[model samples]
Target: MASLIDNNSNVCSMEEEIEAEAAVLKQIQNRLAEKMEVGKTAPPTEEEQKEIDARSIFIGNVEFGATVEELEDHFKGCGEIVRTTIPKDKLTKKQKNYAFIEFESSDSVENAMVMNGSTFRERQIVVTSKRTNKPGMGAQRGRGGIRGGIRGRRGGQQTVVVKYVYVNGAAPRGRGGFRGGRGRFNPY
Candidate 1:
């Protein structure tokens, strides 16, 4: 009888918790539905992006714990620092071990490039001109991941990757030959 009572109490508590969770979820769903009715903010235009890229220098091999202030201080000698960006992982929200520092003048790019391979926080950081982002990120559309076969294309240079390319028509389909007997895979 006591075990029965305990089981009933546990079931009751679980039911109450589930009802509470469903109510909270419904409230969240309603809020999201209301918000989705509004227009989303647009991304930066191409010309604006080009200007930013021209002023920006990508800082690679940055320490995970490095702050924006420290990066600005380190690169301030090059020119007037406009903005410093250290991207964070979407899920973990931690620094991605790289940063971008944008100076007010494009000329500062050369000065910052001079600091390439210099030690910063015990790590040799690479400073380079920011490469323009490929529109589709190697994908046919802006849909998902990079499609196979297309290696890369940049600065009027084309790169292709091919594997197991057979000059003849079809590959030979045959059985294998075992070592015990002269069993070798024959491509006939």
Candidate 2:
């Protein structure tokens, strides 16, 4: 009967030990979660991402020496900042002269946009709404397509380019270098 009492005491002590260890583990986990949130960025949920996007501003011509703290201080008057992202060159780890600042409210975004062309760290920064790279959107294709030459292929000369595409005879590919094939044959 004494041995049975001792066994019950041992089991109770073991249960208490397990509960103590679990409590310690839970505390550790909570501390680690706080550290992770402070030091590392976690991927935002879809709605959170959209909220961020809508409340963000694109800042162009940002000085290379600018830091997150400086940016937050500068825009603090606008509203509470959720994040500020300055893209860096992966190879050199240097700022790429641009940044994205996300605020906690649309009013903050408006206030930031009002600072467009304001001088920041000796550069005239362009502040605008954050733009996404959707097709048929953002900056247009820029002057665009097919280099013809210094003078370019004249409108009337397009036929010459079309005619030589399927020439069957011994055309011999004149002007074969950078000047390209087939000198304009006047054949008058």
Candidate 3:
């Protein structure tokens, strides 16, 4: 009889432990469901939603001193201005010579493209699709380890060479083995 009572007690303890575990599991599931419902039902604010829904247009080659207000004023002729932003330098806190202008509709962006190649602040402006690349992504990180290694092995174009030939086209001679030697006002 004592053995039978011990067996019954053990069974009851085991059953109680299982019931406690089940209760804990049920609570966890309830909390997860509540969190999911909150995430699904609570929508973003109007301003945030508008930012997400609005189209993005790139305004490149802007002046370094251009202000957000100035950008808005200039592009206002295109259409109903949604927002104008000029990315600032991380350390210097100055404009980075580029901007983004979002308009109320696609037509506004289309109209703004006409302003491309026009001079703003004495610098020619470039308008196109907003760069989709994430900020702070550098060439070192952009190329994976293997590709980066291969690129490192194959030396890339020298900055001075590229600037002289492609960009400025007036290569300073003598030092870089460029022909015609150094001239004061060399055009070609």
Q: Which has the greatest lDDT?
A: 1
Structure candidate 2, residue pairs in collision = none
lDDT of each: 0.82, 0.77, 0.71
Q: What's the alpha carbon RMSD for model 3?
A: 13.3
Model 3 residue 63 CA deviation (Å) reads 1.0
For model 1, what is the alpha-carbon lDDT of residue 137? 58
Tens digits of per-residue lDDT, candidate 2, 77-133, equal: 999998899999999988899999988888898999989998989889999988544
Give stretches of model 1 more than 4 Å off: 1-42, 138-188
Q: Cα miss at 150, model 1 (Å)?
A: 14
Tens-digit lDDT track of model 1 for 167-186 = 48754346422112234566
C-alpha lDDT of residue 99 in model 1: 98
Tens digits of per-residue lDDT for model 3, 56-131: 5788889888888878887788888877888888998887978988777877877888888988888899987554
Per-residue error for 179 in candidate 1, Å, reads 28
Q: After superposing candidate 3, which stretches have Cα over 4 Å from the reference?
A: 1-54, 131-188
Q: Over the full model, what C-alpha lDDT does candidate 3 score relative to the true structure?
A: 0.71
